[model samples]
Target: MALLMPASLLMVSATTSADAADAPQNTTNARQAKAKGKAKLVAMPQIVQQGKKPASAGSAKAALTATIKPAKAGRPVALQVQKGKKWKTVSKTKLTKKGLAEFGAPISKGGKALTYRVTAAPYKGAKAVTSKPTTTERWLTASFSDDFTGSTLSPSWSNRGIYYEPDSLRECSKGDPSAVSVSGGTVKLSVIKDPTRANERCVAKKDGKSTGSFDYRLNGHIGTEGSVSMRYGFAAARIKTHKLRGQHGGFWMRPTTAGGGDPRAEIDVVEYFGDKHPQGGLTSFIYSTKNNKAVKTGSWIKSPTSFLKNKKDGWSKNYHVFSVEWTPKMYVFRIDGKETYRTKVGVSDQFQFPILSLLSSDYEISQMPGGDKKLPQTMNVDWVRLWQA
Candidate 1:
């Protein structure tokens, strides 16, 4: 202390003191810069709009998602719709852990077009941000619709696979008029024991080899093959699927032409394989030909229960709207207006018609414990509608 220190050590001590004196100011400047920075909001490129019938009041909604830069979790985001010249908030939600906000808004009104945007209020240190406005396309009245109000199948639908010709996939089942009935504003599609072959058994074969023998069953299969078809648009049906794993309940579409070559794609909007199936058995897929070879897209839906109304609800317990939006670029599948899956592969450009069926294939018959005792599994269809682009 009293003695003089070395010149080099003295210089080092002075420098250390200076740095300590300036540290607080440096941190203050950095904090000010961050507090002045503005957050950025980006919205999805396309907003899908759905058409709803008079009976489906709240089902006609669209999904909108946006991301906030710098990732501020729990930040508030508002979805706004353009009302006249000003924007009105329609939905409000908090940002997810990934700084993303999603909103489902009841914005579709018959054939009218609507515009929407997202806004994030100023947060702890970031400035307010707004997303670019997105205008939805006009959704006109559905070109094809059946409410199933009549006591019989409409002229629009025809029975399918009435004859029992064995196929590699469905070796034990065939369609019959008795398996389809219309009443009470709904069409009942059932998989029942074939009365004509009540005492006979059907052998399921693959590649000319018999795999197993099953009870002869008749399926409920019907389609609008000749009466209604669309090139690209939205198709939807409200259905309560069959309750057992032995049969497959499907809301699907196929090209009007018979051949299964290029440009002929099969679009399965939704398929359910019963409640107890280990895989949840909910699927959406497409089959198409590419380079003269078969190609398939999509798979079983993950977290299928997330689409249900509650823990007590199931595909067979309540009716859910299954829909597919087809465009030139891709197909988007949805359950109850919420997207389940999407794919750009195997996009069909040909006119496609909708088909509804509850099929009992020989391969799946073993899944049902009681065999023919669980024979008559019925799927109910409340209605079907199509909006052409």
Candidate 2:
């Protein structure tokens, strides 16, 4: 499993203090009486920064603080700072009514970054009034976990389907495509077109030659079905495609059916095939089903549609982090933590519930331009993960 680790080692404490203007007082009964009626009111505290660091590259903090007067009597007015995107509680029971309130939690630094706002209400009010968001600090990287970076096959992967044949899309062949291999540190699978190979399987040659006459399309695809099934979490992969040849590569999820009879749903976290479209560049779809392949519904997929170029460089010889977040009712696409695509569903289609597997395709190469001429094309998967809610 590939995991991310904090590159730096530094711990900073969160604290707050009262902001007051201390002026010399007049020593007179009449003056004191007038002063008693006019006491200084403190402004609500604002978060100078979201965290001690930045959430992701190009990410910034959304900060807010409420200015309020000191509460009368002993009834304390407690303040709290909570997260909006993740909905995680950050700081609570703060007594400061002015100056700054620190919420050092990690937030999206760029592309509609997460924010903090001051919420004020009477201690006895039914609801509090929140202030508008004020951007402040930068989001920094957190610790990493080993989600996908290993060789040992776990029970999470079934390896049950017919081995995919290299260069072909046919099924039930002598060389089935399902027999994908991961030895040393690399994961390998065949993308074949012929369905008659053994176990429907085929292999790519290191010398850039076809191993079989079937032209089968066989490649390895693994998931976290039995190992992990998180309700709400994040999954990402850092990958680079084989040069020149165009192939489909992505990180996606599908719901597991109950007793293998429930409706299935698929969330195409991110699918990149070189086909260019007028709206953008890539084409993708978000699909759902009532029963496993029983009734399939789909929506036009978007995001990562535009490509990033460095002067004249293209999408090759580079590694990008393709990530997505699955909530209870929605899914979000992110490139290095910046959100690009966000979709919501009113009803739980029950389609996108399973832990997703990392997948690559060299199949149907004949359908692609110069696919037959291209002797060798490969997709490399860096990692896969599920963040538990």
Candidate 3:
């Protein structure tokens, strides 16, 4: 219409046009502000359980995990512990690419129950958020513990496979007391050339067929067979593995009574095949009887390098605690208090005892050509502790 509007009407019409022109920008700004505020609302950090319920105090360590809203990665998260009436920040870590943060809850001595929480710090345009408090189960004293401060292996331990000789699996290796020793507050387990068979060369075999030749070796194999056994508990060892590829270092458990109508099970808490090996060489598995036939569960730990402290920290380079939390429902495997794997299959309810060994098997000796030159590959155990459930 060509007719001009009144002054007052013109002003109103102009204001309407201006408001319409600003609507999209204003709405966008509101959305941005709302999103920034919402980003502060992080999900409560959850305790990663070693069993059906939240991890108890008896575990080597507790893991707390949480996610940030709006997928903010690389943000800092702090773990806090409640003491008396105050909360103390104990540890801090940055979030991963997927907006995840996992904190290893610091445990105190004497097995006392503790409360914990996590907090995300204010960053960029987002505000801070704190998780709700969670209390851990009562810390239980270890039922069995060995610091290896003595000059001899504890009476609680007995040599394993001492009389065993070259077998199909271990073509040229056997257990010998000489391969295990206690001193310097640690137990040293070694794969060494058998003294009596130092000059002997053993033919390595695979599937009962000769594959190659290697020197005779003795392993540090010991167990708490009749001395210590538990139905369900947490078993842990502070150990540093051997650095070579020819041998295996194991912290495992087997039923105290085997080969009857009992539930037969083998819990391999942790196994290492030395450094730089393909497939990472770290595994946690269970072998159990199903329908009167053997069934295996678990596998090589995935992304094993993620368990290490740094690029220079190999499994053999530094001492780490390898542990298993055995419950009637499942088995949770951990390295240095960080869970590596868990499974519900092949859970053992029978009384099982712990075993430690550094062994050479024929099937793997071939991978370490001329490996005998690196004889006496030793694994060190700082201590072993068990908390029975």
Find the candidate with the highest lDDT and give its number.
1
- What is candidate 1's CA lDDT for residue 59? 46
Clashing pairs in 1: none
TM-score of each: 0.77, 0.48, 0.77
Instruction: Report the C-alpha displacement of residue 335, candidate 3, in angstroms.
Output: 1.4
Error of 3 at 238 (Å): 1.0
Clashes of each: 0, 88, 0
lDDT (CA) per prediction? 0.74, 0.39, 0.71
Deviation of model 3 at 295, angstroms = 0.9
lDDT of 3 by residue, 1-389 (tens): 21222121111100001223333457765454555322111111112222211122344455445555444677787878888899999888886776656666644446565667667777665557666666544223567888787799878999888754554387588889999998877889998888797777999887778877788888999999989987675688777788888889999998877544345589999999988888998999899987888899989999999977777777777777788877678787877656688899988768888999998888888777467788878998877777666
Q: Which residue pairs come into collision in candidate 3?
A: none
Q: 189-284, model 2: which lDDT tens digit per residue?
A: 333344343343433342354433324443345555544444444555544444433345545666655445333356666655544533333333
Candidate 1 ranges beyond 4 A from true positions: 1-75, 82-88, 94-104, 107-115, 122-127, 132-137, 205-212, 258-264
In angstroms, the error of model 2 at 44 is: 26
